[model samples]
Target chain A: MQRTPFYQKHLDAGAKMVDFAGWEMPIHYGSQLQEHKQVRSDAGMFDVSHMVVLDLQGAEAKPYLLKLLANNVDKLKESGKALYSCMLNEQGGVIDDLIVYYLSDTAYRIVVNAGTREKDLAWMRQQLQGFDATLTERSDLAMLAVQGPNARAKVFSLMPADEIAIAELLKPFYGAQIGSWFIARTGYTGEDGFEMMFPAEQAEKVWDALVGAGIPPIGLGARDTLRLEAGMNLYGTDMDETTSALTSGLGWTIAWEPANRDFIGRQALEAEKAVGVQQKFVGLVLEGKGVLRSHMKVTCEAGEGEITSGTFSPSLGLAIALARVPVACGEQCSIEIRGKLYPAKVVKPVFVRQGQSVLS
Target chain B: MSNVPANLKYADSHEWILDQGDGTVTIGITDHAQALLGDLVFVELPEVGAQLTAGDECGVVESVKAASDIYAPVSGEVIEINHALEDSPELVNSDPYAAGWIFKLKLDSTAELTGLLTANAYSELVAAEA
Candidate 1:
């Protein structure tokens, strides 16, 4: 199994290791619940080096990304701005969901899921046949995500004097290059923090510094619960190559304003839009005993749906799930768990945002 | 190192039984089992007065990672359940021996206790798995 630069650090911290997409990564240090609560209340760090980072350069980078992604790159007006978008196939099925950072007019940085790295790279290369864009995967870098209510303060307190000012000025969804590090004020845990990418060799030092500054190391176990509670869509679980963004709670990520611009899946998406989506993505909260899990059949007035991602929400003290139900389904539904049906309430897909409950 | 209480008898599947000196016994998952399952987020306990057979799945322990079945170590009718687990499932992780006991069962047959492993044997089983 492939190991990240911080694999030894994880072992030193008494982490339970698990294989995640070929990477031997930490599942948790001890109690995943405590680590989750720590991130929500104080500060926690995650070793996210397994995620792939690619640099797209050259004059055609702008045009290349516009046609390559379902979301228009033109929306990124300023440097250091980041946009979340889905790369689609001809059938409008999602290839991958990614974050693209507009570093400059000619250079852009994109981060894709680790599990889909090979396929995503191959797809991006195929799309670059005519464009002058050059995609370079950065293998010499390690990434860390420090997240929570006090995450920024904890991280900033450890930053060098010269880098502190620029780091403080970074707004959400924005990033900046400081010395050899690239720091972004964005996260997946619905909290304020920085996702920093630095030299792979310096990872241990930086991780030690962060831990010394009172940031606890979190494992992938809590990461899943945190993102699910935040109502974020996990790429493979929530949507995959067989799913479309419109039916996966990601309709807002698609940009279709420029009528003349023909993206890869424009025709297919337009056709689907014309016919109206058959299924709708919704969040569920179990009202009865039992935890809701993925693949559990959800029965509603309209028809049967299935949970794509479900988990017990530590913050809400209840089980929550994201499911794709019939578009006409109402607020109440029943989930079949272990041959028994349990009642659940339908609500907005986001359960929490900015560490606050979004559900009423 | 996993904690295997010397006073308890264990099933190969990791459930532990405590003989109460009456025709009754208390049951819960072993500490090793709880540690393997990670943090408990939700738990579904068998209802009081529910009949269960040996090796039958009677309850569920769910963590952020996954859900595991809590099997009945011996056959009997459940006389009582730890209702506190309904609201605070973490007890399974915090104190898997005393406060996390799933239920008390009126032992259908005392002979069934002979099939359980001793603390030393359970420790060996956990070591072999590791």
Candidate 2:
């Protein structure tokens, strides 16, 4: 199994390790529930070094991305600006969900999931045929995500004063560079934090610094729950190459304002918009004594749907799940738990944001 | 980890069997099982007075992460169950070694208990699985 720079740190912290997407990663530390609650209530850090970082260089990078991504890249002009886009198949189904950063006029940085690294890289390279783009895979970089309300203050305390000044004013979905280190005000856990990228060789020192600063080393178990509570989607579980962004609660990332700018999946999405869609993603809370789990059947008065991701929500103190079911499925529903169906209530996701319950 | 109470016999599956000693055995999941499940969100206990064969699935323990079945280590009649788990399942996590015991059974064939691995063996089993 491949190991990241923080593998030893995770081991020293008494983490339970698992093979994830070919990388040996911490699944949890001690108790998953305790770690899940810690990230929700306090602060945490994640070694997301397994995620692939690809840099696009060459004058035609912008136009290349315009033709490649479902979301437009025209809005990103300033250096360090980040845009969340879905790389879709020709049929409008998502290939992978990723974040692209505008590093320079002729350069951009993209971070993708570890599982889809090879496929995403191959697809991007194949599409760069006409463009003068040079795709540089930065396997030598390590990513660390410091997340939660206090993440900024904790991380800023460890950063050099000059970088902290620029980082302090960084708006969401934006980033700034400090030499080779790229710190972006973005994260998967739906919290205010920076997904910082630094040289692989220097990552252990930064991790030690964060450790001394009181950021608990978090694992993938907490990562999953945090993202669920924040109402974000997991790439494979929530939406994969078989699902489209429109039905996956990712329509916000679609740029339709510039109607004239045609992107790769625009035509297929337009067709779906015209004909309407069968399924819509929604959040669910179990009303009975059952914890919702992924792939559990969700039956509403209108139709049935399957849970993409489900777990006992630490923030809500109840079993919560995200399901993709027929559209217009209403308030009351049932989740099949162990052959028997139990009651639940459907609601919009975003259970918690900024450490507070969005729904009361 | 549940006390494994010196009086009760356990299966490697994480179930504990309490010998009611009158040709009957009381069965339930162990504290280790409950802790592994986490946040006892749900319990699908078997029906009272239901007959079960050794190794037959009797019920389920559902946690926030996933669901696992509670198996019958010995064949018997399920005489009683903890209905309290249906309302507040956290007892399984809080006092699984004691009050969290799942169900009671009247042994049909005591021979089934022989196949079960002891508490010490079960502990080793979990450690090895990890």
Candidate 3:
């Protein structure tokens, strides 16, 4: 099992340990619900350095990214601009979802899920084999995701004045480097914060500094709940290679314009667009009593679909889930719990974002 | 360190069985279980009058972190259950030994209780796993 640089910090915080994507990671410091709320109301930090960070460098980086990624690379015109997109197979099925950073004209940085790192790298390498691209995996970097309504202020307060000034100038979806540390205004949690990446050896110091600055050290347990509340998709749980982005509530991320640029999965997506997709992904809020769980059956007249990801949303004060169901399904469905079924209301995928309840 | 409380026998699987002494045994998951499970969200208990064998799956305990099976440590029919948990499941985290008692069983045989580990033994078992 791989241990991140912040492993000792988690241990010191008395965090409950669990295996995640082959890494021994912290599930919680103490109470996952409390941690979830802390990230919503106050400031919290998560060590997400386990996710692979790969730098793609070479002359053909732009054209390669334009072909390999589904989202428009034009969205990242400025250097250091970041964009989230899905790397797809030819069938419009998602191979891996990634965040790409336009580091330079000839250089790009991409971060992918830890579980799909090997496959993502292999696929990227194969695609770039014809192009002259160099893939360098940055295992020496450690990333900390500081998120919440108060997260940015707290982090900015602790940063060196010059670094803070530089970071403050960075808009959302953009990154700036101060020394070896890279700061970006992007996060999985529905909050304003930075995903800061620094040298692995410098992580413990920064973590202690964040703790000293009163940012709660959150773990994977609350991380899952917070992201789910924000209507974010988790790799392997909410989606995998077998699923299509169209059915995974990722239609908006697919760029189908400019009719001539043939990207991977373009044909299948165009076919699905012409014929209409069969299944649709939606969020469910448990109105009746019961906690929703992954793989629990979601039922309606249209058919039975299983929950891709579900949990008690601390922000919503109820259980919420993302389920892939038939397009013909009703707004209300029942989730089978133990034996009896509980009714749930289907709503927009995002229950909350930027710490605000989208439903309310 | 002993927020776990005394005066209760515990099963290695985390069920805490309190001997009512009159014949019935009140059972609940331990504080350790609640601490391990994080936030208590939902629970599904066996219906009243349901007979269960030792180690039978009588109920489900779900925390915000994960869902787990609550096994019966003593064989008997469930005489009563904590109906309070239906709405306020966090009682298991707040008071696992008292208000969080999952069910009361009419013991078929007292000998079955002997096999259950004591609170100290249960703690030791947990320590070994840790």
Which candidate comes out best when scored by lDDT?
A: 1
Candidate 1 local Cα displacement, residue A32, angstroms: 0.8
The residue pairs found clashing in candidate 3 are none
Per residue, candidate 2 scores C-alpha lDDT tens digits across B71-104 of 9888888888998888777788887766777888
Q: Compare the candidates by TM-score and give the number of the best one.
A: 1
Model 3: DockQ vs. true structure: 0.80
Docking class of 2: medium
lDDT by residue for model 3 (A223-263), tens: 89888988889988887888989999888888887777788
What ranking emerges by TM-score with the best candidate at the front? 1, 3, 2
Chain A: TM-score in each model: 0.99, 0.97, 0.97
**Estimated TM-score per prediction?**
0.98, 0.92, 0.95
Give one digit per residue, the lDDT tens place, for model 1 in A1-360.
Answer: 999999999999999999999999999999888999999999999999999999999999999998999999999988899999999999999999999999987899999999999999999999999998799999999999999999999887887778899999999999999988999999899999999999999999998999999998999989999999988999989999898888999899888888987888888989999999999999999997667889999999999999999998888888999999999999999999999888999999989877789989
Which residue pairs does candidate 1 place in steric collision?
none
Flag regions of model 3 displaced more than 4 Å. B1-6, B109-111
Candidate 1 docking classification: medium
Candidate 3 chain A lDDT trough over 10 residues, lowest sum = A71-80
- Residue A243 C-alpha lDDT in model 2: 91
Please state how well chain A of candidate 2 matches the true chain A, as a TM-score.
0.97
Clashes of each: 0, 0, 0
Docking band of candidate 3: high
Against the true structure, candidate 1 reaches a TM-score of 0.98
Question: Which number leads on DockQ?
Answer: 3
Residue-level lDDT of model 3, residues B33-113, one tens digit each, is: 888777888888889999999989888999986889999998998999999999889999898888888899999998888
